[model samples]
Target chain A: MVDIPEHLLIKTAEARAKALGISVEQALAEMKGEAEPTTISKEPEVIDVKPIEVKEAPAPAAAVKADIPAEVDFAPETRVTQRLLTVVKAKPIQKPTSEPVDKVNTWPHLMLPEFISLMAMTAFLIFISAILQAPLLEEANPNITPNPAKAPWYFLGLQELLSYWDPQIAGVMIPLIIGVAAFMAIPYIDRNKDNKPSKRKYAIMLWTFFLAGAGTLSLIGILFRGPGWNWTYPWIDGVWFDDLLDWVHFE
Target chain B: MKNEKIKFRDRVKDISAGLGDSLKESSLWGSIFRPGSPFRKGYSDSPRNRSYVVMNNVLYHLHPVKVKRHAVRLSYTLCLGGLSFFTFIVLTITGIWLMFYFRPTEMAYVDIQSLQTSIAFGSLVRNMHRWAAHIMVIVVFLHMSRVFYHGAYKAPREFNWVIGVILLLLTLLLSFTGYLLPWDQLAIWAVTVGGNMASYTPVIGAQVKFALFAGLEATEATLLRFYVLHVLFLPFIIVIFMAIHFWRVRKDGGISGPL
Candidate 1:
């Protein structure tokens, strides 16, 4: 082995490091025949290994697998699992659940398009009314009696009912009583389980009769009867009958 | 690479100048656009906090606690039995509008006449209100019929049915009270006759009549009574009933039958 000067050795090491694109310390360490450079401060402190107490996770997967065998076993049973097995069997047979089926097209389910169209039609009607300033008859001149100074169309039916009976019985009392009774009876009267229109025959018929009777009676009373005091008319002459009819014309 | 760096530096300088100009411009814009700014408190963005924002809201009770989507869509759409409810909202709007100009006095008849002829769109408002009122009655009847036909009033819904009956009477009362407000000969006579008829109720007829009219004849007091009943009293009753009605629908398995 030949001896070399420390300064020259350091210069040569620097040159070699630059050429190799390595750090000076790396080259120096390699020249010294060291396996690894003393770069890191110290070996990382070893952590103590303690035994872990691990609780097993719930056996959901095993339970699911077990359920199949349990179901298979249940399938052979006659009484105990019959209903449950039937339900389970049915689940697989059924198509996947989707959106609900609409049974009767009731009022609350109006589509946006239909609602818009309805609103448009209503608006158009209102516009036409506005444009026309829809003629209003002379301000209900009480002194100068008009021929058919009638109640609005809806009340005309009730007005007609006034003609046939006493105002107390026919006009106010009877109607009120009947109305309250009818209203109270609604739930009781139509207690069928069926929601289909076809199944509700009696209910439909009863309602139809009620509507017709109310509307027809009101129309007849309003149209035929004359207004206020002294019921006898030239055409429909009986005094009491005319009085009854006049009672109906109050609205 | 040198050229690119120079270009990048110039771009950065340009961006910095632009940003400064924008900041200055924004200050001027802010000054110009500034209106009277009210003081605002910081609020929590959590949903539970948001819910309390409308604690005193009028429409809080309008909606039921729990609603099945199907029930809402069905009840509010299609055949539109629920459209009657919308009509009621319209009635409320138009009614309040009418009240702005109307005086519920003995002069109500003449006031109505003036509204018919003199006020702008007054007759239209009146007519719409009148027609809507009538339509509401018809629609309600039809709705009841539909409910009956569908067997929606059975079992747990029986109490609701009873409530519905009360609602129907209230609706009729609303119509009747409104009718007397016009105070024309028709209104006067109709109410007089109606009052007299009440006087025939076997035992409490006269008392009922007196309570209703506030006197023997249908006078200013009667008009005021009817006005209060029409606008305030009956409305309160109906609203309370309506809340129960809607809530019951939710509780009773949401309109019945299979979904």
Candidate 2:
């Protein structure tokens, strides 16, 4: 007869009692009968299955420590009942499902960057304003209009368009259509899920060309269109609007 | 004599302690900031404190508490949108100063002459306003290009993009209106050519042009109207839409990140 630990015997007897719905004494009698015949033959099988069951349980994540499950199932008295307990224990222990943030709180991190950008921008504006002067030529005279009279630089794009198209199309129809399409239709028209430039090649290419066209037109209107709104280089200055009435057909 | 000196020193300490206590409990100090100053021992840093800094201040509230690191990258945003708004602020300040010496009628040209020739720092302010206005136009367009290229106009941000388009139009209109305020030949004829473009619309074309100029031509009524729009109306509209635009940026998860 091999000497079995008193606590192991007690735990085994209790596990059997619970599994069979019988008293601990009755379970202990049955375990003694089985042990007398089989001895340590069933011991390894019980130990192996108990640890595997505990390991497979997704719950009780904290029990992942190597020291815990071995101590929990050290009792060799009733292997079948202890296996049942492992399954039962797996259900109740709650797990933390959400991802951990691992992020720093936004105090000095966000505010400092914004403040620095604003300061740099203000300094640049002050430097530019110090040197240049606004243009003011003569009083409001309806008669003596300047030759190649140009709109403000922003509207120079429209002025450039006016050179090539009728006023209704250049001023109203084209701008209205472009504005509406850019704002309203773009989101639906380009339905790619990702924003990577490589992923959205066609969308990126079209918008780039559209912007380039507008910029180029503004540049031509600003620098290239000279007197009479003719195709004259910016350097030429002698003949000023000699044929303005003919070009615009104002008569 | 040593005991007498000790008593006097204790009396001085007592009075100074009372003064410090009173200052700590004062309403003036409380009015300056929240209850406990950060310099105090128990003052702690927290997420709530970070949010409170923005919530409690008027100007800082315009920004969000926790912005993603990618959104603030200078290479990604180029800070074009922020620069546009900053330029508008510069314009407002310089524009107000220029208005002090500017006359809006035919005398507007002479007033500008005197502003350049006589008024102290007048030309500097006018120049600042003019250049700032031009910079704002260019910057707003660049900002639009940045938004488009980033695909920032997609899905939930769609409406904000529309508001941005309207804002760009207002910016152009605002610049055009201010252009005529100088009342120079350049101002008059450039506006004449621009306004005539509206009259080319089909059926209601003449009516639209008349409504714009207030007569058959660009005259006193037209100048007054343009002044009102440039100074008051358009600015009001821009500010209202800009508020919506900024609030939407926060609502739409700050600036767009990668994908």
Candidate 2 C-alpha lDDT tens digits along B1-259: 9998567434422222434555645777556656223322233455565566666667766887667766656788888888888888888888878888876676777888899899998877887787778788888989988988888988788788888888988898999899788887777887888788778877898999999898989897888889889888999999999999999998986778554
What is candidate 1's DockQ? 0.10
Tens digits of per-residue lDDT, candidate 1, A177-200, equal 787786687677666766666887
Residue-wise C-alpha lDDT for candidate 2, range A131-212, written one tens digit per residue = 5455666578787767778876667788899989987889878777775565566777777867787888998899888888
Candidate 2 — which residues are off by over 4 angstroms?
A1-107, A236-251, B1-26, B35-48
Could you tell me every candidate's TM-score relative to the true structure? 0.57, 0.72
Tens digits of lDDT, candidate 1, B1-259: 9998566434422222333445534656445322211111222323332233222234432333333445544443344445556667767878888887777775676788788889998988876776667667877777776676666677878888888888877877788788777766556555665566567776788789999998877788888999999899998889899879888876776666531
Docking category for candidate 1? incorrect
lDDT accuracy of residue A101 in candidate 2: 29
Give native contacts recovered, as a fraction, per prediction: 0.20, 0.55
For model 1, the interface Cα RMSD in angstroms equals 7.8
Which of the CAPRI classes, incorrect, acceptable, medium or high, describes model 2? acceptable
